[model samples]
Target: MAYTTLGDTGLDVSRLCLGCMNFGSERSWMMNDRDASVDLIHEALDLGINFLDTANVYSTGESEEIVGDAVASANRDELVLATKVFGEMRDGPNGSGLSRKHILDQVEASLDRLGTDYIDLYQIHRWDDDTPIEETLAALDHLVETGRVRYIGASTMTAYQFTKALYTSDIEDYSRFACMQPEYSAVARHEEANLLEVCEAEGVGVIPWSPLAGGFLTGKYERDGDPTDGTRGAASESVRGYFIEENWDVLDEIRALAEAKGATPAQVALAWLLHREVVDAPIIGPRSSEHLRENVGAVSVDLSDEEAARIEAPKTPRWPAAGKD
Candidate 1:
């Protein structure tokens, strides 16, 4: 596994973060086996993956528990453990959002579940329009000051919201977000419009989620046929959004390039993210050992500038290319 610092921070993390969302039984497509999840995490750790990203809401903290169990025998100091807040972890009052009360309450719960006192990186799962950004940032700053969280980050949100949070942190002396977790892949280039440019300008590290476009770029789903049974695309309506003709064209390009390089389409797709200068790591959530190994293999698959461009040409970029009106 390749290692790099998280954004501009000195905290070293694997180029591919092990996403723990699939470890729980919350969804039909999830692994749903605690032992199996633990084993998968162990396999990833053995393969040199030091970064693990999970959230309190994933299977109601079951994923974190599984991660905690898997990392128990490993060297703790070498791992970069991350988790998220701003998700509904319970019912009724104080159940979610980035409010100070929820954040304070959730951090302890996350630490207890993860069996760790300090989170290497704690992120807000989404923008909390309900709570003031100042309140949220102050709470996260408290986490950093108290040593409960080493660094703070944000997930999918508008460029304006992210910029506001960053600016608020600068003025308030709060813990600034060190990185961002955006939905970015060869098939999903929407962030390139403004969010990515802001991240680039602000020197924030980007660890993109769903780097394979929910398995669309892997060519697992047939263009003319429905998703195979038991697949995430089969179970998730959001995944079905990638079935349009345009994404199929993107997959065609990826498939051709993969054949030429003697690599799986998934590897070629992930390698495209690895090739981006803004991407510090692309979080890979593999349910099985085979999938984990295949995704990890992407680290070694090099792509030339022309090949990368070919993979991108099928989809029109949300942001206009430089020198183009």
Candidate 2:
């Protein structure tokens, strides 16, 4: 696994990060494969995957506890641990947002659950429109100064919220978000509007989640109409099971390009994002060890100009909103 520096911060992270949303209780509805999750986490680290993305709300913090156990014995410096906050953990209003009380309270809670003293990259899981951006920044800055957090980032943010964050950081001398996480895939190209432009100019590492479009680009659904049937469709056991006719057309084009390159569609999809200048890394969420291997295999897949061009954005419903245009 090749490591890339996160923007200019000098924090080296693997180009592929393992998202741990399925680690704990969040695994309940999304992932009932705890044993598989644990094995995948260890194997990913063995494969030189140093970055592990988790969140407080994932499985209601059980995911953190699970991830905390996965790398308990590993050297801290050898890992690039990242997790998120700002999701509701309590019913009261104080339980959520980027407020100082919430931020400070959640940091320690995440630390305790993660079994670590400090977080490598602490991201606001989502933008808190209610709180002042400065208050959030000041609280985050305090975390850095006190050694509770090494760096800060944001996730699932709109262009407007992100712009304010940048200005607030500049004007207030608080720690700027070193990176931005958003859903970006061949199918979900919504972030192309202004987020990508700002991230490119500001040098914020763009870590794209769902590069596979929630398994849409895996090519597994190419045949048998959809992978939404039987075992694979358990997650999305709807009428279409997360696969539809239009998505099939888009997936077909990508598959043809992959076949031409002797690669899988999933690999080709990730390579497209990896080649983009704005992207620093693409978060790969897999359910099994086999999927982990397949996802990592994408690192070696290369796409030519023509092949890359063949995999353009289609007129489909975008889920991630990070790979717009």
RMSD of each: 2.9, 2.9
Tens-place lDDT digits, model 1, residues 1-325: 8899988899999999999999999988899899999999999999999999999999999998999999989898999999999899889999999999999999999999999889999999999989999999999999999999999999998888999999999999888999999989888888889689999899899999999878877788898898889887988887888777777888899899899989999999999999999999999989889999999999999999999998888777564322110
Give the number of colliding residue pairs in candidate 2: 6
Q: Which residue pairs of candidate 2 clash?
A: 24-63, 25-59, 26-59, 189-323, 189-324, 191-321
Q: Give residue 168's lDDT in candidate 2 (0 to 100).
A: 88
Q: Write the per-residue lDDT of candidate 2 for residues 1-325, one digit (tens) a residue.
A: 9889997689999999999875664433456666766777899999999999999998788888888888888888989899999989889778888899999999999999989999999999998879888899999999999999999999887788899999989998999999999878776677876577788888889999878876768876655643444443445543133365555666788888888878788888898888787888899988777788988988898877766666664544342432322
Model 1 C-alpha lDDT versus the unseen true structure: 0.91
Query: Candidate 1 — which residues are off by over 4 angstroms?
Result: 319-325
lDDT of all predictions, in order shown? Answer: 0.91, 0.82
Most TM-score-accurate candidate: 1
- For model 2, the stretches where C-alpha displacement exceeds 4 angstroms are 27-29, 222-227, 230-246, 313-325
